[model samples]
Target: MERLSLNQITTDNWNMREAVEGCARASIPWIALWRHKVQQAGLAESKRYVRDAGLRVSSLCRGGMFPAATKSERQARIDDNRRAVEEAAELGTDVLVLVCGPAPDRNIDDARKMVEEGIEQLVPYAVSCGVRLGIEPLHPMYAAERSVINTLSQASDIAERYAANQVGVVVDVFHVWWDPDLYRQIARANGRILGFHVSDWIVPTPDLLMGRGMMGDGVIDIRRIRKAVDSAGYTGPIEVEIFNRSIWDAPGDEVLALMKERYTQHV
Candidate 1:
C-alpha cells in the first residue's frame, strides 16, 4: 500500500472526484491521471480533490501524439503537449508520460524522426515548467495507429538525448514484457526511469487498446520485471494500470480491493 498506485483508466467510468474518493477509501497512496479525466473534473478542482484525499499524482498519462499530415497540424500537437505540461504541473505532479505518435503515411522511419524532433521542441517548455517527460513505448500492435516508439531501447535513446531530470522512459509491463531485451534496456535506463506501470498481457487479447489484464491474471513475469526496475534505481510508485472492459464494469471499490490484494501477492 505504501508504493502502490492506481492509474485512472482502471476505473474508466469514475469521475475525478469519485476516483479520488475511491483511492482514499482503498488506502491507495498515489494515482496516475489521464488527461481527459482531469479536464472533465477541472484541473484545479481535481488537484485539490486528489490532494485532499491524501493521494499523490504519480504521473500524468499522455502528452505526445506528434505525427500529423501538415506542418501546422504538427505544431498544433506540440502546442497541445505544452498544455499537457501545464496541466501536470498544476496538478502537482512532476512526471508526464508521452505516447509518441505514429507517422502519417505508414512511414515508420519518418514517424520516428518526427517524434524526436517534436520532443526536442517540447523539452525546453517542459523543463521551464519543472516537469519531467517520460516517453512511453507502446506495443508493436499499436505501431500503425499509436506510438512509433515501440521499444524500451527506442524510448531510452530519445530520453538519453536530454537531461535525465527533464526526460526519461516509462516502463509499462503490458507493453514491453515481450521484448527479449527488456531487462537489459531497463538496466540501461538506470535512474532515468520516471514511471513504472504494471499490468498483465493476456494471450487472447480481444481489444488492441483496452485489452490489458490485471496483475497476476496473465502470464507476465511481473515479479521479475519489478525486481529489475527496483534494481535499476527506481524507488517510485508501482502503478496498476488495467484497461480491460470487464474490470471497468466491476465495482470500483471491488476492483481496487483486488488490486491491493494482487499488489501484495503478485507485485
Candidate 2:
C-alpha cells in the first residue's frame, strides 16, 4: 500500500497545527513542507516535532522560480534555489520540487531557455548538497505567470540533458490531466519521476487558480493516472496538493478528516 502525507496544514491556521498533529496521530508517515512555514515554526523545532511525531519528510514544497528579465533577478532566483537545495538536504527530504518560472516578457521559448539554463547552473550545487531537483510542470494556464515547463516531456528532456546526479520531474495530475501525451510522457519519465501530486479539476472551475476538488469529488481519473505512474516504476507517495479556499476556510481538523477519509477510500 502507498502511504499518505498531509502537506503544510500547520501554517494554514492556528488550528491547522491540530490537523497536522492529528495526521501524525493517525500514523501517516510522510509530509511535504513549505519553506516559509518551516521558517516561521523554526526549522530545528519543526524538524524535531516531525521526527518526534514519527513522520518522514517526503519533499520540500519548492525551489525553482528561475525566469526573470534582469540578470540580477535571475541570479537572485539561482541563489535562492541553491539555498533551497541545502535546506532540503537538512530536512532530509528525498527531493525538492521546482516550479520553473515564466518569462516576464511573455516569450515562452525564452522562459524555457531560462529554465534549462537555471537547472544547468544549479545541478552541481544540488549534487554537492546531496539533494535532488524535481521539476514540476505546471498547467498551461499558469504558463504566463508561474511556470514555463508545462509538460512532462519537457521536464524529462531537461532531466536527460543534465548528467544523472539526481535531477527528476514531479508529475501532478492537476497539471497534466489535459495533456494528450500523458502516457507516453510517463514512460519517458521512467525512474526520473521523483514526486507525484494529486487534486481534482472542478467542472466550470469556479476559480482557475484555486477551487481544486478533493479526490473523487471532481472529474479527474486519478486511479488511472496512478496506475500509469506505477507502471512507469514510480511507487512513491501520491501527494495531495489542493489549494482550495473553500477547504482552507473550513475548520482545519474537518478538512483534514475529509481529506484522509477520501484519500483512503478513493485514491
Best by lDDT: 1
Which candidate's TM-score is highest?
1
Which residue pairs show backbone clashes in model 2?
none
Q: What overall lDDT, based on C-alpha atoms, would model 1 receive against the true structure?
A: 0.93
Listing every candidate in turn, what is its Cα RMSD in Å to the true structure after a full C-alpha superposition?
0.8, 1.8
For each candidate in the order shown, give its overall lDDT on alpha carbons.
Answer: 0.93, 0.82
Q: Over the stretch 20-61, how does candidate 2's per-residue lDDT look in tens digits?
A: 476676666778888887777777777777777777888897
Worst 10 residues of 1 by lDDT: 201-210
If scored against the real structure, what TM-score would every candidate get? Answer: 0.98, 0.94
Q: How high is the lDDT of residue 50 in model 2?
A: 75
Clashing pairs in 1: none
- Runs of candidate 2 with Cα error greater than 4 angstroms are 9-11, 14-19, 163-165
Candidate 1: residue 175 Cα off by (Å): 0.6
User: In candidate 1, what are the lDDT values of residues 1-267, reduced to their tens digit?
Assistant: 799989999999899999999999988999999999998988889999998998999999889999888899999999999999999999989999999988899688988999999999999999999999999999998899898999999999999999999999999999999999999999999999999999898878878888888888889999999999999999999899998889999999999999999988888
